[model samples]
Target: GGSIKHDISVPVSRMADFIAQASEAVTARLPGIRPVPFGHIGDGNIHFNLSQPVGMDKSEFLALWGEMNAIVHGIVRGMGGSISAEHGVGQLKRDEIAATKSPVEMAMMRALKQALDPKGILNPGKVV
Candidate 1:
């Protein structure tokens, strides 16, 4: 059995709606996978995890990581929630953030990175 983990944060008021939408989206796209969502609802952050179905191939299930991220993160984004909650973006979410962020925002981030770490010495190729 393998597991996929994702974290998202939405407004406290919309926590219930976000959870419903997210669950529906995941189940609709991946009927066989069982989503085990849990976290601090007080702040509206959810640590959504998925477990591979019975008799499912580990590699095959793990291969859905990116696809699941897209499905789940899309729902989170549409609900005005952050794709990365608590955990800062790393290589795992670099492309997702780039795709989700605006061009101007991306440019500003790059500028800041370049200005602060001209040689890309700090955490090279991690974020931005």
Candidate 2:
């Protein structure tokens, strides 16, 4: 079974809340879904992962990747967390970051990207 991966960082103060609320939120959607959340508690960077329910088909559980990401990421956003903690915005998260950053922030990023890679040749779609 493929596990959906989310590397997110919330404030140290909100780490506990993020875990509790996110666990509750996802479980509410799919009963018996096991949350295997763990990581650096001091830094507030958590590899908030969910393992499939017992006896459920692996493909079926894998099919919920997008929904599970939205549910988990939504909670991360609500808590002012970075969707990517240790990792940068690569192919997997380029599109999703727009929702996380403000329009002005995004625009500034674009401007910087343009200044740095005027020809649009560096890691083409790996970031904003």
Candidate 3:
């Protein structure tokens, strides 16, 4: 009854391929894990939720969150999609975003953060 969810967005044209490939990737790596994907298809965003397999330990299944994120987010990135679309990067996805973002993009983001919130007081340890 437990599940881990990820928010991802691909271009409208690549939505179908993204879904198929993502599902295959997850299922391949984690057999028996149920991938229940849903969300704003019109806008090309998907809330990909992986349900724990029958009789699986909730904590153990949930522990694979990062691994599943990588599988799904990799497909999204391959399709030129964003791992955190609409939902800005927060603490939950900070490390993943850092890992996925390019050096120049991260630099620009850090620069903006410094320029706007030099004190690191507003939402500290987030976004940047």
Q: What would you estimate as the lDDT of candidate 1?
A: 0.84
lDDT of 2 by residue, 47-105 (tens): 99899988889899999999999999999999999898886678888898988989997
Top-scoring candidate (TM-score): 2
What are the TM-scores, per candidate, against the unseen true structure?
0.80, 0.83, 0.81
When summed lDDT is taken over every stretch of 10 residues in candidate 2, the lowest stretch is 119-128
Winning model by lDDT: 2
User: How much is 27 displaced in model 1, in angstroms?
Assistant: 1.7
Candidate 3 local lDDT, 1-128, one digit each (tens):
78988888899899889878888988898889898888998999888889998999999998998888888888888888888877667788888787778999888888988898999998898775
Pairs that collide in candidate 3 are none
Of 1 and 2, the candidate ahead on lDDT is 2
Q: CA lDDT, every prediction? A: 0.84, 0.88, 0.86
Model 2: lDDT of residue 112:
84
> Per-residue CA lDDT of candidate 1, range 36-118, in tens?
88999899899988888788899999999989888888888887888888875778888889777789977887888889889
